[model samples]
Target: MYLYYSFIRVFKYLCRERERRGQTMYLRSAARGFLAFLLLVSALHGYHDWTVTYTSSTVCALRGSTVEVSCSYEYPDKLQNRSTPVETLWFTKEDHSQPGGLVSDTDYAGRVERSCEEHSCSLSSCSGNCTLRIRDLRQSDSAEYKVRFITNQPGGEYTGDPGVKLTVTDLKVKVPHWIRLWKYLECQSMCVLSDHPNYVWYKNGQHAEREITKMFYIKEGDSVSCAVEGSERFHSPLVCAKGIKNLCNKVTYSTRTMCVLQGTSVDISCTYSTYRGLKLKEKYWYAWSNNNEPTDLQKDSEYKGRVQYPVKERGGSTLKITDLRDTDSAEYRFKYKSKSHEWKSALHGTTLTVTGLRVEGAAVAPVTEGQRVTLSCSTRCLLPGQTSYIWYHNKGPVAEPESTMNKLVLDPVGLQHAGSYSCSVRGYPHQSPEETLTVSCIMCILCRD
Candidate 1:
């Protein structure tokens, strides 16, 4: 704020000077160009100095445990170089400046080095990754961290000068701590919602920079990797998401975390842009079935006993299930609803390909509360990058304009998600039978006595 105010004063002074000499044409033109150049330089400076991105800023950690802050960077081509290695300093802005505060100053001297392999200004190392470990973390460590990188720009270089801040909070961890007690755990992770100043994640052993939910599950022998770099799954092949963690460079500080299950509790999460999410009031977690009806698992008994929405800071929705079984498999989904009544859906579906089950499963009825479930049946699909996908469920018509694919994810499937799902490709002019879809699924019991 101090620098911002100082810059504003200088900017105003410069403008006043230009106005004072407006009568001089030559002076006016020169001043205008000078101002423009300054503005561009300012933007560039802010771009590098102001950025403190994380692969996965907020990490979900168990209470009375440790959590790491994965902070990374992306600088302009000119400003970032290997010889003049950019020094990343992690500390509390004002609280503790005694050369230390949350993360030890000397701790990351060697391990938290920069990576020149990918992004010239990337942060990574061999000992592990660019993760900041917080030991004996208190409930307060659940706040954003002011992560800054200090580097000098040549005196005449057209570089930028800005400060970078990344959040480092320990959002509540999903699933019981006992689950990871005694397993090599090649897969599976819980949600950790937080508004850290800067946050990032290193799954397996690489920088999870993209913010989308890239499921680690792959086809047989497809080489499901434990390294964060190996996660290639993007579209849920079920429901699309709004805040699905994409590991991309985003302007908003808020984020989402999605978990994929092979045969158990499925947790779907979404985080919004940072500042706008401060006073979180309502975060509606929605789902659909094969029929495309909206369903709220929060109130439904099917989820009432097991589902848990742990975000109390800036409201968020969480769907948790226990007693992992084949029958509990289904296309689980969710979306975000804010205070202004604005709505955006990142709903997704997960087809539980039940391999081992006794009785033929049936569609679970949306018990008497008369709730709503959203069945995504559109031909429009958009990926993290460019190019979109189409969605379809049951025999619904969701294409008017050109759509990517004829795929739809049935969320919160009650009796509707139970219907025979199919989708007709878009741009085919007529709903051709060749482009139709038929969802093949098996059912089972959710809980055992």
Candidate 2:
């Protein structure tokens, strides 16, 4: 008989075999049989002496984001004493007897990571604490995963049962009927996430602050959208009231123009605001060419590894470029996309000028006491504009008469003037490395001789 049928027969027999005088003997016998069956089944499955636990049996995550699943495992003292775990991994299939059965299958290549803490066999707690992290989640990536390990001892392999189950979902915004003009709009997902993450609201397409209650009030001709916090890419479709969509569009650069030295790094910053209901499809930097349309600099071979777009705040982003060259001088602009595209290139952009910087006077030289010396700071090109220079003596600001002067003069140099000196361009963050100046007291030296 099939194992399932045999269990059914045993259950039926237990039900029919009533003890005389309605005593509890039948119940006791049934309980003992069930316990014995469980033990037999476990032994048959090679799980007789091991225990595994999952922090959460189920996990729900948004598409295009990342998630983590946590787990732990333990084994018998006899196995611990005789063997040591050499390889630990996670898989979605029990046929690990074959290759390519890992949970990080071809479909999830380069997107899955597993981390575990190594533990000695003699430890009383779990032998391993493992966590699985997956990035750029997709609908097809959802599945149940199991933890497995191989030991150094001969024929020592184990797989944990009842592993974690994962589900990926997309976000959506729920709007009420237009009849109620001032009702609340809801940001929802197809299924509830593991921990019920906070929701964020957007109007016209730009991200607003997080909504504590996952609700936004509706107004006439207003288009509102919503997304889960930290998973903005998986936002829901826009829900508009009064059958009209409001267009919210604005972009402004922190400074219209800036100048920097070649071989240095510079940051171009900007703040933007967009309509609530529109979704941002793309964001990038571009520069105008000679009589041609602007070209995206990100794809240019020149900026392959020298450009960075740091994480943006709610309404701002920064572009940082290093190892700048004269050729890098151009008009730089930030552009973003939405479902309802708006092209306003003329209103938002920054002009950058790259020039070489250097100190004009001798950095290090011996000077006689009572002699006068002059140190001047200069740049290679002054077409863009002349920048005021700030001089420092011994790592501190220069004296009042020499302050804010590109050319610093020290008359009647004394022993006290024998120290380090440096200069920097005003409004620039970097300063030249300090140069040492040696002043000699010939009279004192002659006396010592």
Candidate 3:
């Protein structure tokens, strides 16, 4: 069962690594081919008893707050009876030169804790769970975390790969737009908080009735801010609701930053207002240039075919970019022209980050017959939603029981499985670099003996 699980993990690693590295199409094609072969092998073997399951694959938390990541694991009772756990560790980074680095050894030294429980399960298996708690979260603490345990048996260490991803974000008070009557304000973060925490609103630097909601209303000229209920110290920056006179010249973006996968599409939008009765002459989106000037995206040759200005309602405009490329990453600002005035705020605009997928692990490795193998798909940033991955062998797609799964497993590998492998996100053309799988025949070794 452990062998079977290991194969699955390997496949997942390959897929993930490929996406993260954003390798070229040739490499990605080869890696997909290898992953497909592994998936075929695992499908023939069926289920495995050894497994590790995380309560949540992704978590979002506020800076300065506390968070807990938990998972449960199961192993065959036969191994449990003969082997005892020698070590258990939780880590954000894996060190190939040694065992994985513990969270405690990192900057989290005084703020991390771990707890575990173990018990027998149905006499044929043993089950256990472990929870990792991190306090006073820092923005730098955002990372993918994995748990590993070692047993007394030879080659008895296992790690939960494609582990939990943690995102730490600061609070921001979304300024109310004129359409909302300039009365409502919202507390925002990059990702949804895992705890679904209550929010505390502040008016003019003072607690506003200890408000327990994410949205709030403010009077003209009043400044509003927000924080998690118990974390008032980390409140968001203040935003002034300065009436029409101040709002008439302002532009407000829907978001400050966006992370997207290469080959995907993204839309960045904003709302703007001009002095009353001013005839709007022109409106457009532009990216910052090295010359300290804003170049209209529509006029730029680089964005000619890929850029579109989706017509929006009265005060809103959207910049849509399709088939995203890494080179597209930049700060984008919105500008509008009136007959007598041009509005372009000194404040920063939206930032877009484009990441490509790359498969990780060795490009070529010799596998002995009957050895378990795994491949994985990965990305630099934890993708926003559940991502579906496609595996390829040689140059064509590989058939698998679960087409959406990012992992490919080969249990008890055979010579027929040797090939070039690659992986890609479903619905996207980008793929990870190819990985070559080489198989060594066990019968040949026996014959020599």
lDDT top scorer: 3
Error of 3 at 371 (Å): 2.8
TM per candidate comes to 0.23, 0.45, 0.50
> Model 2 over residues 1-449: C-alpha lDDT tens digits?
37757887877666666543465777787878877987787676554456667898888898867888887776544444454655778877555474344543656644577888885566432366788888767798788877776665444666667788888888776654434445556666666787677887776455665874444455554556667767554566555555434434545577655667877888898876565645677777777554866555677788879888885666677889999988889888777877776533433267787876455554355777888887766654332334467777788986752343356777878888878877877666677777777898979878899
Tell how far residue 355 is off in model 2, in angstroms.
27
lDDT of 3 by residue, 1-449 (tens): 56657766776776677778875674566667767877876775434555678999999988866899999886555554454564568887757835555553636644677888864456666678889999767799999998887655445667788899999999898764644443556788999976677888766445565544434555554556678876655667657676666544556678766778888899998876654546787888998664767778899998989999896688889999999988999889898887877764435567787888665543365878898887766665445545677888786777672344456787877887778888887677778888787888999979988
Model 2 residue 140 distance off true place after TM-score fit, in angstroms: 1.1
Name the 10 consecutive residues with the lowest summed lDDT in model 3: 209-218
Weakest ten-residue segment in model 2 by summed lDDT:
378-387
Q: Which candidate, 2 or 3, would have the higher lDDT against the true structure?
A: 3
For model 1, the stretches where C-alpha displacement exceeds 4 angstroms are 1-50, 55-60, 76-82, 93-129, 135-140, 152-449
In candidate 3, stretches whose alpha carbon ends up further than 4 angstroms from where it belongs are 1-238, 242-249, 275-279, 289-291, 337-348, 399-403, 429-433, 446-449
Sort the predicted structures by TM-score, highest score first.
Answer: 3, 2, 1
Question: Comparing 2 and 3 by TM-score, which wins?
Answer: 3
Instruction: Judging by TM-score against the true structure, name the best candidate.
Output: 3
Write candidate 1's Cα lDDT for 32-108 as tens digits: 76678678778866655434456663455433244566655544434443444455555544445332433333332
